[model samples]
Target: MARIGYARCSSEDQSLDVQIARLTEEECQPIRSEKMSGASRDGRTELAAILDFIREGDELVCLRADRLGRDTRDVLNIVHELDQRGAYLTVLDPHITTRGEAGRIVLTTLAMVAEMERRFIKERQKEGIAQAKAKGIYKGGTRRVDREKVLAMHRTGKGPAAIAKALGCSRMQVYRILDACEGAQTAA
Candidate 1:
């Protein structure tokens, strides 16, 4: 049986050092980590890789249940998948594991709490943005991509993929900009 570790963070700005250190302290081998939101299981390649390669009797370790997932259903699904593979999930913070019924119960409760905390965070963020707007100090989020440049590229008959490659942005971003420009023209 092996102890494998998985660490995750919501954004690129967040550090995974603490989680990695804790996992190392736990003697977990081949630790996998990623900088991605835990709100959902989508697009989490590292986590998916761990799940795919995990074998029976292997323990999946994380610093906390929230690191595994912020959504209750997603956490539960992960636990279920581990169970099916005869693997276990070990959470360090509350010291919960999926090796027993009690651990499963505690993990479930913690998962629910984590989901609630995520919702509360979103609500607080919305309230803060609203307050900022009321104070006339909210300039809105900074654009990571230049809309005019994207439009210029599109006007030059560049495809979404080509424009994205040239601008160093995702094809989705290029498509969204083009769609918005088209909508604006239709409205005008």
Candidate 2:
């Protein structure tokens, strides 16, 4: 049976080195990794590929249950899928494997805890933001797109797609800027 590994992180800024090292230490081969949020199963192409190609008797390994997913439903679904394929899931931290009924119960409990922890984190963040706003320190998130640059490009007869390409941003962002500018001019 093949022992495959999967590593994931929430954002590009986060490192996957530790997780990868742990998986390697466990003698896992062909480890797949991605820098994406585990809050949801969406946009996790590497994980999807693993599920798609995993064969019977193969085992999917991760550093922790949370590395597999933070959502309980998603994690349970993944485990179910693995079971259906005659494959197994091995989480390193708690050292749990889906090779037994007891392991599945513990995994389910851990998945629930992970989901709850995610909710707690979000709640804490919201409270922190509220406190910052109360102290007049919250100026909202920094803008990644340049409104002036978008307007300048549009004035030069550039289409939304062309402007987005030039600014290295999405066409929807370009459209939003253009729409806001148009609305402001109309009001004036």
Candidate 3:
């Protein structure tokens, strides 16, 4: 059984050398590393490659569960795949290995917490966006987006969905402006 090690750091300011050291101490053979944000599926190529290489009786070793994936759904899928293949996952610092029933339960709990944390972050971000919009803040520090072309597109028999797609605005914004245009037309 291969005990493959994985390491990652989300930013340039962080280093993977320390994680490598710890995993090496644990005798995790053939360390795979990446310096990229684990914010989503895009940054998980190395981890996914390692998982692909692993087979039944293989073990995946990482410094921590967070090191594996920031999003719970990501690792939960990995864990389920591993479970199906009769493979094991070992988090060195946490000292939890999903090689048995009890280990599976612990991993499941962590996955749930990870999912909850993800939802909470999304909620906070939504509220922050609402607050920013109320204060006339544009995302990415950009100027206010013009909706003129969007309006023209709508006046030409294009639906709000199409206008929104072309303008890169939300359907709600498109609907709001369309309603305003209709009201103006009626008043005139």
lDDT, residue 129, candidate 1: 99
Ranking by TM-score: 1, 2, 3
> 94-164, model 3: which lDDT tens digit per residue?
68898777877877677667667767887998889889999987465442336678677866999977876
How does residue 92 of candidate 1 score in lDDT? Answer: 95
- List the candidate numbers ranked by lDDT, top first: 2, 1, 3
lDDT of candidate model 2 versus the reference: 0.91
Give the alpha-carbon lDDT of every model. Answer: 0.90, 0.91, 0.77
Residue-by-residue lDDT tens digits, candidate 2, 1-188: 89999999886567889999999999999999986678999767789999999999999999999999999999999999999999999999989999999999999999999999999999999999999999999989778788999988888899988997787665666777888989999999
Q: Which digits, one per residue and each the tens of the lDDT, describe model 1 over residues 78-142?
A: 99999999999999998998888999999999999999999999999999999999999998988
What RMSD, rounded to one decimal, does every model reach?
A: 4.4, 5.6, 10.6
- TM-scores, all candidates, are 0.78, 0.77, 0.61
Deviation in Å, model 1, residue 61 alpha carbon = 0.2
For model 2, the stretches where C-alpha displacement exceeds 4 angstroms are: 143-188
> Candidate 3: which stretches are off by over 4 Å?
118-188
Looking at candidate 3, what is the lDDT of residue 6?
92
TM-score, candidate number 2:
0.77
Q: What's the lDDT for residue 102 in model 1?
A: 100
Better of 1 and 3 by lDDT: 1
